[model samples]
Target: MATPADLPDSVYLEIFSYLSVRDRIRSSRVCRRWKRLVDDRRLWRHVDLTLYTMRPKVLWHLLRRYMASRLHSLRMGGYLLSGSQAPQLSPALLRALGQKCPNLTRLCLHVANLTMVPITSLPCTLRTLELHSCEISMAWLLREQDPTVLPQLECIVLDRVPAFRDEHLQGLTRFQALRSLVLGGTYRVTETGLESSLQELNYLQRLEVLGCTLSADSTLRSVSRHLRGVRKIRLTVGGLSAPGLAALERMPVLESLCLQGPLVTPEMPSPEEIVSSCLTMPKLRVLEVQGLGWEGQEAERVLCNGLPHCSVIVRPCPKVSMDWWM
Candidate 1:
């Protein structure tokens, strides 16, 4: 019988693949051979430090040790302590990351402060970028030179990022390859910004605009007119209008529609009107109405009865607490 130490490096690597990052790190301390196997570039392809709260310097040190050219995705979370300042991401650390991880494609930062960092500091190879409750500088996005913008970015998620505004929306039009976009808790975005952005993002397939002050003019008219190719859309806005509902019927490819937020108003459309609009949509498969009060359940019943093939969901709006940002 062969001893465990007799196992080949490939065998050790295969075993390491099944272990979590922390477990892999612990395994490295077993022996020199295991340490070397753990350091292999393949094992570091996707690094997630979302649960760890460390200083920027400490994170940089770890990245320098394990990060390799094979690294593609990185997820990090900043410390959100009460009355204590969170660790700031330094420009030097990002520059080094870009240089070391040339193939890095996905970058997710939660509760981070990127106010001092410029857009150019991010890896150019990134295809998916997510920033949740982050303080990103608006000027950082606008100031980037035309040549160095994230050219390959396909998906972007900005949730509860109070720093992002209308100008940032206009600036994001440069990313012509964008496919999926999620904007949540970004209250400042208005009809003008969204309309202009929608017109530019021709390739966008999925769009979610939550916690924004919008009405039929923004969600219905502009989106239906410009985003005819969009397959899925989630909008949190004010009461619906007749012309707006009519405009929504223009989308030839809409498969999923989610109307969220405190949408019950005096101008709110009736269950019959909404059900009539859904009947006209040939491709619509999923219809969800949240925060529409009593009408939501009524519409759900009507939708299920009318469109037997479609899925209908009705629910109250979720309450957002101030602590959620932290």
Candidate 2:
């Protein structure tokens, strides 16, 4: 009887997928059959090496040889490519992966530092790209490349990263079919990228530009005109004023609004003012304004006097208390 290690390359790869990376790497050493199966580029569709804190050279070796054009998703540990000792993922490697893994759907990079190898041609079917604490350039983020390369690309989430410093929304025009996008901590996005990003949201239903700056006329006007598909908006501002709430008027379908900021004097709407102003929104079911605990006292009163038709839900410092108001 043929042992598991003695199976044909095709048959062994099926079982190989079930084995852990450490086990698979071990099994790759057993015999020629297992080695060939492990080396077979098709067997390595998803490369996630969170446990292997090995050298970048090892990671580079795996990506360079094993990952095929059909490779779909890639998740990696933190990468620190600097100094004299270690180098990050090479541009050649990235371009190779970009060429070979034309079917890549998701990429999650979790590291303190990384070398940004901007990909010119991404997989047409790529979706759900995530990066953490990596130093990527603006042109890379805002590349107006061919959409045929990334036709189905959508859902980009960045955390504590600086990819938006230069590019902002320049690259967003390429993703014509984008449905959901979260731009957290890409503060480099000034008014230029802000306007560019917002104006081209033909299919953007849920957009979260969390930490990008939009404190200018161009921003408010562009947002008012283009981001009219505003259903869920979370804004963290220096101060919240009547004019800010007035922006909600533009978002006719806005159901939830969260305004948060850190200042000695709270700058959020009083529960009364919020209920009164947002009374026109009969569909407005949820409104959260943190640090505005002062509003809790007069919330019901303002609702009864001003906008008596809709539910006036108000909570201040609820986030701190972890409160979920009824």
Candidate 3:
């Protein structure tokens, strides 16, 4: 019946900015100035309720009272303070919305049932933090978030997180405008605490780890000597060992390298013995090998020997077969 105060205020704040706090309390009965413009704090910037509703803390006290001055960005997994049954966040409502959301930046917490993250109760004005399946301590998030003098942090996506420790390793060497870091489902990890957290990410270039567990091989060759401005390195060394493939020959501008693993035996090495030990980097172009156990003449002699330059791609894993890459 198009009621809700004849739908204005920019179409009821763009339809109560995508409802779902049980339909913003059943659209506040469409009256009394649309329930004061649905408890206007400019109809809350962006607060998605994570669905499994029943009035999660009265929608977290409607974001800790009267839309805590039009909060910035807050996307949770489900409710109380982050789903999966929602609970931990009541240290006085995370210290009164971490002392009233000073334009809180972006917090997309998924949920893993806590390990740490009181975030000293927030207000560092975060830039981007996306942690899915979080059971974080990340050394109490580098001693309660500093982000290099809080200069609008760059990016951090810890997906599938198992555990992140190594007490700040020099505060990730002072972010200094970090680029991109993604650790996807890293399994059973230890590699000397990811080689001193990879030389403090000295302005990290771009790196991704999927299912890793690296540790020895001279601590992954001293964690590949800080990957000299790494250009792109994705890995899946499934159970990782053998000096973690000799620590990718210490990354000298590693152009590209992707490896997905499980085994083809001899403790898995033959993608032409890992491109003849990364042919001394010199800016490698590309080399992708995914569960190589179908051999194809040793994956075509590890993609035509010496890599000829680089650009090599192999995807044959299909749950391992073909005589297990003879």
Candidate 4:
């Protein structure tokens, strides 16, 4: 009778594929054959090391061993401690990654220090890049001499990166294929910077600006004039006034609109004003109004009554603490 150890390598790999990263690591310690089977490149297509507490050297070794040409997505970040600083990502590691994972398409770095990494060190095949609470200068990536560095990049999300500013938006023009952009907690992006940046992106479809002061009539007018093809937009009421809201009429193809964040005490638009302004947008189908206080209900009613052809959703913003960022 054949024993379990006599099973073929393919069978062991099949079994290992069903295990979680932690479980797979545990299973690898079962025997030499199991370890070798676990090390197969096929089983490491998507690597996520966010949950593990690993040193930089250990992470580098793991990537070198398992990250073959087939790797598609890689998420690596350090856990936040009470008072201890997070570990910085090494330039050597990024250089090695660009060489080893040439085919990687998606890269997410959360709470990882990027001060040492160079923009050219990133793999050119990347399609989506997400940076959350990471320390790095946008100039490094945006100022690359070759505009074709991130040729296929479509989406970029920057959340709570204090160093990012309006000047960084200028760098985005280098990415011709960029379509969707999310900017959260970036207070430095002013109206002038935003208008100038939007002027260059004719293909931008989805845009979200949250927790920032970008509210200006001219800014929306600029958006209306430049981004006529925009399909989805999310912004705070404080960022847009009645005229600003009316400017959206220029985008006849807009499909969804979300208005969120705290209402500006005296400048908030009334329910009637909002309804009257939005009526001009012919293609709007989904409208979401959130984070407003008592007035949110009135706005919802007016939207439902005025725009029978569209779907309206209204909800208050959830309470978030500082720990939520972690």
Write model 4 residue lDDT over 1-326, tens digit each, in one string.
99987888888888888886778888888888888888888888887777777777778777776676868888887443423564567777777777888888888887866666777778788888888787776655564457878889998888777778876777888898999888877778888888888989878988877777777455567769889888988776775677677888747789988787675546667767777777888898888777876445666778799889889888876476222322
**Which of the two candidates, 2 or 4, achieves a greater TM-score against the reference?**
4
- lDDT for 44 (candidate 1): 89
C-alpha local distance difference test of each model: 0.78, 0.60, 0.61, 0.76
- What residue pairs are clashing in model 2? 69-100, 78-111, 138-167, 142-171
Candidate 3: residue 250 lDDT (0-100): 49
TM-score of each: 0.81, 0.64, 0.29, 0.81
> Candidate 1: minimum summed lDDT over ten consecutive residues — where?
317-326
Q: Model 3 over residues 1-326: C-alpha lDDT tens digits?
A: 77745656778766886787557766777677767777877667777655554344665667666557578877666232444555554445545554677786766666534454455554456676666766756555574465444456566666665665455434545656657666665564456656666766656766666554552243346547865777776656544555567677747787877666653345656555676678867888888777655446657665756788888777664452111211
How does model 2 fare in lDDT?
0.60
By TM-score, is 1 or 2 better? 1
Give the Cα error of residue 304 in candidate 2, in Å: 13
Candidate 3's C-alpha lDDT? 0.61
Top lDDT model = 1
How many pairs of residues in model 4 come into backbone collision?
Answer: 1
Where in model 3 is the C-alpha error above 4 Å? 1-57, 60-62, 66-75, 79-100, 103-106, 111-125, 133-153, 158-178, 185-208, 212-227, 230-236, 239-244, 251-326
lDDT of 4 at 209: 77
